[model samples]
Target: MRGTLLFDGRCGFCTRSRDLLARVDRHHRVETVPYQHPGTPDRYGLTEQQLARAVWWIDEAGTPRASAAEAANYALSAALGTTLPLRFYRLPGIRWLQEALYRWVSNNRQRLPGTTPWCEREPGTCG
Candidate 1:
């Protein structure tokens, strides 16, 4: 696996997002795995709480790389064979904006399209 993408398997939106990534992963570089998979958190050295907060991408050796939007960026970049508007990471304020946007979307994911009524239910219920 070029990298492992740990996501919320139970979240409809997250699952859908993973599907989209797979569709574009012609070279199959990303290993998108749901954190709910047994022993996944331990394998990646991530806590359930951290996995709950956002998507995570770890390079092959299982080194923590990025989370949330940054993590997604890493996976997509690898998928398409081009780094995320990587220069943006160096631009003043751009990185902050990207992370902020991810937080907003994550915090309100239940309200986003593709999320079913059941997905809006109590915590674990959404999964």
Candidate 2:
């Protein structure tokens, strides 16, 4: 199944994360695109502010998955062709914890690795 991972292209941290995903994605089913790409956001029904806040996963059916942790799990599962992580993501309590962690990281992404001053100054316009 084909899918797209939408992210802020200008964010150093986000770009690096994309790179890591590319490297680990053995199935190559996921395509990473900057939200600023022409018509990308509109095609996926996403907004600049939403893309700036978190990563998104759009499936082959064009269904959007907006939760950061869920997106990651789905992408990784597609790459590995295994449902273990997906099962874990669906587990009670664990999903909530992962969501909280994802939110914390997304909220403070500028302070994370690969971030630059531009990430803090003009979030959605980097690329």
RMSD of each: 4.3, 3.8
On lDDT, the candidate that comes out on top is 1
Worst ten in a row by lDDT for model 2:
115-124
Q: Which pairs clash (backbone N, Cα, C closer than 3 Å) in model 1?
A: 10-127
What's the residue-level lDDT of 40 in candidate 2? 75
Q: How high is each candidate's TM-score?
A: 0.84, 0.84
Stretch of 10 with least lDDT, candidate 1: 117-126
lDDT of 2 at 11: 73
Predict model 2's lDDT versus the native: 0.77
